[model samples]
Target: MYSHLLIPIDGSPLSMGAMQTAMAFARDAGAEVTVLTVVEPFHIFTVSPEQLQAKRGEYERQARAHAADLLAAAEREAKLLGVRCEVVQVESDDPYLVIVETASKRGCDLIAMASHGRRGIAALLLGSVTLKVLTHSKVPVLVYR
Candidate 1:
């Protein structure tokens, strides 16, 4: 009987699927949903200040556009399900931290997201955001595979 459910998505197929699944659950529970998309800041290894200045602006601009498109699509999905929806976009290097903080700040009763199955080296490189959220979140977390 959650009043507000937080769904975090990254536009991956698994995350999108989790969004759909959680939206259905929200509809059934008569709970409003908040869809969050967190964009990690772009990393650059170059030493040129000019390159850094130029590329950082472009990277953020595109990331913002992409997040907007992704959130808009999610809003449409929620509308189709007749579930009240709000969308949030955040930029951070630590996505799991952002997700947890957003859930607490928004007063979301639950955090639902996909368990992106990255293994070994890939997991190490990308970091298991879902696991981090599970470990750190005070709110309940529902993970969909």
Candidate 2:
């Protein structure tokens, strides 16, 4: 049985669904869950420092706010399920790597997340963070598709 579970979410319907499922699983196992939301740094090709500064600041604010909202909702749900929960937010260009590292650092026995179910060219272009986490993480991953 898992003593701790790490659930990474992107605020998507799929990820939210997975989070709910993982929360239930954690409650059943008498395990706590850490809900993680990784906000990617804003990327832009602006030569003007003023524009870059302003836009990047705005993006950062919005991203963190959204992450906060998501985490709050998750916390409420966890409370309703009577499961202990911890929430974390971080900025990283590589969210998948962050997820793996956080799982290890938090001593999580399992990493549960949703898969986007990408295929072929679309997957190649957009890339799949879930796939990367599965490939790179040493912790066991439970993928919800």
Candidate 3:
């Protein structure tokens, strides 16, 4: 019953599976898809201004390139499924915030993403983005392991 689906990808194998599942669901529901990849902002202390600027530029370039590659593959998959798709790449320190905000801004009814399945201390240390998104997002979330 969803009209628009938002799928977040991190280039992980699990995320790829989520993408496939989301695409199939979108095709079945005649829904368009929006794929999002959030790149973390580069930050470092104890660096000269010039060095900091150079490093920041380099980091952004590399991150955008990686996001583009990931989004391209998703786009190709959507095309194969005959589903309309759009791609978004954003820089944010908090990916969950970006995912939630993008879903709201794009008017998506559903969010489909993969959980890294981290648990216990690892989950506490590495903070699951999927969990955060589920907690914070108003849109319906369908998570795939």
Candidate 4:
């Protein structure tokens, strides 16, 4: 019953598992999948002006490249399944916000993402992005742990 599916990837194995789940759903529904990856914004306030500029530029470039690679992989998988798909790369410090915004902007009906399965101090330190997305996203979310 879903029209558009949004799958967020971070190049992690956990994220890949979520992608597989999204793929299965897409296959069943004959829905188009939009794969999104957010490249975090580079923080520059703490560094010298020159350093900030260089670091920011480098981070942007790396992010773009990484996103491209991930998108390509996702496309390959989708093509194999004979499914229509789109890839979107976003830049933001808050990946959850970016994911939700992109899903809304792209008119996705569902979001599929992986949980890192963090616990205790590790969870506190890392502050789960999946948790944020689950808590805030307006669309239906299918989290793959």
Per-residue lDDT tens digits for candidate 4, residues 4-123, read 999999888778777877887898998999999887667766332433656667767876887899899999889988889999888876788988998999999999888853223535
RMSD of model 1 against the true structure: 3.9
In model 3, the runs with Cα more than 4 Å from the true position are: 45-54, 117-123
For candidate 3, the lDDT comes to 0.87
lDDT of each: 0.88, 0.88, 0.87, 0.82
Kindly report which residue pairs in candidate 2 clash with one another.
none
Per-residue lDDT tens digits for candidate 2, residues 4-116, read 99999988888999999999999999999999999867778644343366677787788899999999989998999999999999999788899999999999999999996
lDDT of 3 by residue, 1-145 (tens): 8999999998888888889999999999999999998876677862334337667788778778888999999999999999999999998878899999999999999999998632335357768888899999999999998
Query: Each candidate's TM vs. the true structure?
Result: 0.88, 0.88, 0.86, 0.83
Residue 135 CA error for candidate 2 (Å)? 0.3
Per-residue lDDT, model 2, residue 38, is: 91
Q: What's the count of clashing pairs in each model shown?
A: 0, 0, 0, 0
Which ranges of candidate 4 are over 4 A from the true structure?
A: 44-54, 117-123
Query: What TM value does model 4 have?
Result: 0.83
lDDT of 1 by residue, 95-131 (tens): 8899999999999999999997323354676669899
lDDT of 1: 0.88
Instruction: Give me the overall lDDT of model 4.
Output: 0.82
Determine which window of 10 residues in candidate 2 has minimal summed lDDT: 117-126
